[model samples]
Target: MSHLHRAIAFTATLLAAGLLQAGQVRVAVAANMAIPMQRIAVEFERATGHELIPALGSTGRFYSQLRGGAPFEVLLAADDEIPARLEREGLAVPGSRFTYAVGRLVLWSLDPHGVDPQGNVLKQLPRGRLAIADPRLSPYGAAAIKTLGGLGVLAAWQPAFLQGESVSQAFQFVASGNASYGFLALSQVMRDGRIPRGSGWIVPSQYHPPLNQDVVLLNGGRSSAAALAFLDYLKSEPARATLRGFGYEVVKH
Candidate 1:
């Protein structure tokens, strides 16, 4: 087993023997951050003995759940505005918000040569289908819409667009061969510090507003030391490095 798995095994033993003190924190995370979050959660658990229960979905849907008292202690949203909204609505801790990463959007396809680097292929998009997250629910989706518009193809591509409930789902549609191509968070398709397989173009940031993904401590989490610890851990070098590994730009804060 890896070091972390061994540590977790030892932690379980200690827990069974009533020798370790640990706490659990519930986290609501955006779909785009799923992969990195899973790895980060494991590392955080091994390092601090805190358990993270992450629920991933669209930021808008997660926000609605939080507002309805879903019992999440923290949220890593796809956009800064939702966290700020939580603060304004007294749903989150007054000042525990900060940008954790800046997301980069990508135009990707499962076929190795499906997408051209210059993105000229997008101009003559396939008749098959193109996927994107629902613009109303996901920041990535909104960014995708903006990007298509900025490229002057939104009007032409409307009929061929397939909207997924979340960015991950949009990626899934393409990865599963249900769609010819899709726009997704760069992290979704990145592996080993590169686009491990398939064809994709890192969408220019100039095409859309900055995707300043933010995290916040919720009111339900105010009393959880584990929640506070997780927030601190998120700003640590290890966590930032993991985000970088997923092709995200960690925002120093």
Candidate 2:
């Protein structure tokens, strides 16, 4: 072979290796995780050169998709149980699931004076139109239900309910003025410890079950270098910092 031909082949091999090192990983993320996950997706690519392609929606719907053979390599669920169930069903890599964030719930309204941090507004504010995620599908929704029940307002608020398919939609229902109030993930309305352009009351943790968000490497990604690397990236200091900024409590380990 000619030297010119050999040199061309060598250059092509190096380029192929570079592409392999920067492979893309497909991730399925819950709707409520949209903001922080998008930020992480950007940073993850910048730092590691591995691309993340996220499909955002309700975890329950994603659960159905996974069972029906979606091509996602990793799942960032809004709750721990979905991923655990996937692991049990052999759809995910066993022992690959771990809590990435403990979510916080909040009652939010666009009205300037509609909400109080102490949460007495729910009792005092008349039974107007209210929004909540469908508890059967969303952990945040179930948390909202639990919080209302704990506050002894669920029974009264039942008739005024407008159910959203996901927490993101529930936030929109109130944000768009379709409802007077809504329960949402703290990450949706909060950034850097403040609620931007809205009134909100952070629900006390004692009122409901902790929203333990977990991520799992799926069986489809068992061979994906990018998938495993992204999981490792999620545990890094920069990633944890981003989560905290978005109002999520990072789970250490």
lDDT of each: 0.88, 0.87
Model 2, position 118: C-alpha lDDT score: 92
Q: What does the lDDT read for residue 119 in candidate 2?
A: 83
User: For model 2, how does the per-residue alpha-carbon lDDT over 1-253 read when each residue is reduced to its tens digit?
Assistant: 5432343345345434775457899999998999888899999899778789999989999999999999999999999999999999999987778899999999998997888889898886465688999898899999999999998988888888999999999988998899999999999988877888779899999999889999998988876777877777787899999999988998787
Runs in model 2 lying further than 4 Å from the true structure: 1-20, 125-127
How does each model score on TM-score? 0.91, 0.91
Candidate 2 accuracy as TM-score: 0.91
The number of residue pairs in model 1 that clash at the backbone is: 0
Task: Output the worst ten-in-a-row residue range by lDDT, candidate 1.
Answer: 2-11
Q: Kindly report which residue pairs in candidate 2 clash with one another.
A: none
TM-score of decoy 1: 0.91
Residue 222, candidate 1: alpha-carbon lDDT: 78
Question: What is the Cα-based lDDT of residue 19 in candidate 2?
Answer: 50
